[model samples]
Target: MQITVNKTGGFAGVNQRLGPVETSSLDSGVADQVRRIVTESDFFHLPEDLQGAPVYDGFHYAVQVLDGTAEHTVILAGMSDDPVVARLHELIHLLDEAVGFQWI
Candidate 1:
């Protein structure tokens, strides 16, 4: 499995890309964490876009996951009322932290 995260459109207009990292090579615990988030967030079942109207200073995230021949992508805003959106954001944030990136 592989996962990639691209973050853009924050207050500073920062754009960052992390991973395309291979989950199987990651520490078992971290890989498990990623798997748990993917399952709990129902990431593969989500729409291709979750973006709403742009909010000034709000961030946007695009996440992609690949497992075997299957692939899924989800884009979401910085804040949302949808539980899946919130969970995906949390998952990405946790991943960023795990990879040593400062949280936004």
Candidate 2:
């Protein structure tokens, strides 16, 4: 599986992007965790447009996931306590750690 995260609309209005990273290249444990989440998540079935917190000057995330021939892209404008957001947050965190990027 491959994952990519693009963050925009933060306080500084900066644009940041991370990966087309392959889970196979990650540490065994981290990769496993990511794969498990994707497997158990409704990620693949989510709407392409997703609303999150909607905070002013907050961040927006464009998270794209690809597995085999399946691909999905979800964009969150702001953040919320929604389970999907939480799951994406966790996934982003793992990706952040994997690539040495910070999301907050």
Top TM-score model: 2
Per-residue lDDT of 1-104 in model 1, one digit per residue for the tens? 78888888877887888786787877888889889989887778889999876788988788999988889989887446887777787778767766744334
Q: Which 10 consecutive residues of model 1 have the lowest summed lDDT? A: 95-104
lDDT tens readout by residue for model 2, 26-50: 9999999898777777789988888
Candidate lDDT values, in order: 0.80, 0.84
Q: How close is candidate 1 to the true structure, as a TM-score?
A: 0.84
Relative to the unseen true structure, what is the C-alpha lDDT of residue 4 in candidate 1, on a scale of 0 to 100? 88
